[model samples]
Target: LAAGARGLLVAPSWSAPDHPARYEEWVTGLPVPTVLVERLGVPGGPLDEMDRVRSDHAHGVLLAVRHLFGLGHATPLLVARADSPTAQAVRAGYARALDVMGLRAPLPVLDSSSAERHPVLFEETARGLADAVRTGRATAALMHNDEDATWMVRRLAELDVRVPGDLALVTYDDEVAALADTPLTAVAPPKRAVGRRAAELLVERLTTPGAEAEPRVHLDLLPTLRVRASCGPPTSP
Candidate 1:
């Protein structure tokens, strides 16, 4: 606290197991103002409890899933990080869409990494996914981010499968989606806008220092889906 640091624009990582607790402990008693960019350590709290700006990940996922569904994919699989709040929200959106569309019988989630430490499990998972695509059991798959999407596309290629021909891929996070070999279709979160809004809120809070009564600021930035060649028009069943 001796230095000239005024406030913090915080964005917690998905890797943090105790992100919320860490946030509370780190900023609760601090003398300076703080704002969280995405993912809170606390749950069920109102948006107004803290100064925060985050993307509406679930809605974005919903939009993408619906787009796939419109293309004749009733059973779209989601491959995600599995443990992140963002992933959970995306899963919920996928499930809700399936329910609304009156489709069931497909396992909707694929959370990578297993505790069994058995290579067979991963192998089986890969085989099953490849079979699903080849057999038209799953017409499309949604990856948590660009990296996973790229990895899956390459892996499928090794299986003698071609993306958009055998399977369609949509990914979250446009970060490196375009750089992929297939240039995946992906949800592009407003990263710059979220940061800009957080910075603005931090400045306001720092200047006021709770001098004037004000409502807490929370922003849920909407994301857009970037269509690319990875997604193909579905064939009629």
Candidate 2:
């Protein structure tokens, strides 16, 4: 809508590393001001003038994963799409959290992006969970998002594995699915605040032409954990 009206293009984080390069190409011919939120790296040239706000996605992941580990889940698996910055951040945080707990070296981390390429990714992931258990790789798994966690739950049931009994789960984003099924343990991001701040910054830039302000704006929002039945005492059997 903004682009059509010859207005500013204010968008959220592309999340993927390759997206920004493509986005830059798409807006190359346009004369409108473009603002990107939560970008990972610094921009170049005039595009570098675009405004940004950084959130503490890494800390958020760490907080949630640490909480689960502290609750006695020694081996927790992080489930995410392969090669995604969000996934990388979560994995890094999970590793750091485990280190702080005095745990041993890293455990298994699953990437679902590889599943997207193969026709049997879903089935493969479901089948892989059995191996995860047999190898004692992880007693709990933290998904990149709520959608993946929900899918994992269904797959576990199909495999005759009881949630929290056989495997505990956690996810980012406290979406409807998280609350729908006996309350899913999640790390809730400040989505609404992020939106509001992004809009406010863009609008401010729009109103002030050639204003001398910081080229980069970073904002880190603290994440809160929503504990539910999905995670219980590790010895609850």
Query: What is the TM-score (0 to 1) of candidate 1?
Result: 0.84
Model 2 lDDT tens row, 6-108: 3453553466656656676554445655555545443564445556554567777777767777778775777776555566557667778767666653346
Per-residue lDDT of candidate 1, residues 132-235 (tens digit): 87776787888786766677787788897778887888999899999998888999988899888888888887786663248776689999999998998776
Worst 10 residues of 2 by lDDT: 38-47
| Worst 10-residue lDDT window, candidate 1 | 113-122
Q: How close to the true structure is residue 224 of candidate 1, measured as C-alpha lDDT?
A: 97
Residue 69 lDDT in candidate 2? 79
Clash pairs detected, candidate 2: none
